[model samples]
Target: MARRARGTSAGLDRHRIATAAVALVDRDGLERFGVRRLADELGVDPMSIYHHVKGKAALLDAASEAVLHEVEIGAAEASDDWAEIARRTAHGYRAVACRHPRVFPLVVVRARTSPVTVAAVERLVTAMRAAGLPDRVVADTPGVLFGFLNGHLLARTGEGPEVPAPVGEFDAAAHPTTAALAPLLSDVGSVAEFDRLLDTVLAGIRVSAASG
Candidate 1:
């Protein structure tokens, strides 16, 4: 319910505008959001937003950063196992995206050069370094981990139709393997399955490093 200044516009800041925009997106679907809508939400004229942001694209970038910033990586205290920490961090991101499916795509595609995003990446890198990962590995792991998490969440959320509708009960007569695995795929609550896959991936990374 916080409203922008009515008479005075001089107090408006970019952060405040970005925060309002994010709130607007959260309340309404991204497709329904626009500068004018955001301006109305902030109790300011649409032109006032232009003073702080170049346009909608700029505002979208800011909105993406605002959502990403909402992800809390938690205390830096070491876990008993570094791999578990990585898994937990990945799950944390997945959970956030799941809670905000409409906002997740923007976060995934936003420019990585933004200061807020850079800070978050740096924190992850620092944590990886502390967990005994080499600098090169630390630098690359976050990108890979995030990519997987984003893809997994987007797929899980049914953002797009991945599987075609069965003409009639999957037709096991034509394809044996797919039909055999159909039951497994139908299990919607697969968080445990995803966690197991995550551990496998982490183990593979460790093995690859040892081999090299």
Candidate 2:
């Protein structure tokens, strides 16, 4: 491919810049991502990036938005089942996180208030509402669902130590349950565990909607 001019990102616009930024972050991670690096990848000077994206923070936000754009939330005509909609939406979010494990933390921690994020939230809320969920329950359900997914993804990414403390060494005499479960703790946080948890969550939402 012919190199883009050094001082001019000729054909690049905001979307193209954001797209490249996402690829760069996926490759290099947020810790090492910078305008200079992005410029280098694009075959342009660092200042040329500012012509498309505002700066580092805005660029990161754009990249995060790009990551979220990959999620396939589907349209209303596709499915009327609220549980299925929620399940698919949750998986879409999880898929992005899983693909970019290093970049996933950045997605989780940052305030995703972009238009794309807002549209996604609306889709989830709309699904719950279409399922005849109570107005208030519908309003809060998206946060409840995505919050669980984000928390779980963060844990899966090893945000903390595999074993935080030495619970295994604790006396089984005083805390038999804790000591006994310690052995199993290491095996937790699997896809099966996530499925079980999501099932429990959807069940609770159904009950709440039914009761309301």
- Highest lDDT scorer: 2
Candidate 2: give the clashing pairs: none
Q: What TM-scores do the predictions have? A: 0.76, 0.79
lDDT of 1: 0.71
Q: Distance from true position, residue 92, model 1, in Å?
A: 2.0
Residue 165's lDDT in candidate 2? 39
Error of 2 at 37 (Å): 1.7
Give one digit per residue, the lDDT tens place, for model 1 in 98-146: 6777777788777456664566566666666776766667767767766
Model 2 residue 84 lDDT?
Answer: 83
What is the Å distance of residue 186 in model 1 from its true position?
A: 4.1
- After superposing candidate 2 on the true structure, give the runs of residues whose Cα lies further than 4 Å from its correct spot: 1-10, 74-76, 158-176, 182-189
List, residue by residue over 1-212, the lDDT tens digit for candidate 2. 35655554277788888889888877777788889889888777788778778889888877777777787665643887778877877777777787877667777777467565687777777877876789988877877887888877877764356633323366679998898777666646556666788889988888888887
Candidate 2 versus the native: TM-score? 0.79
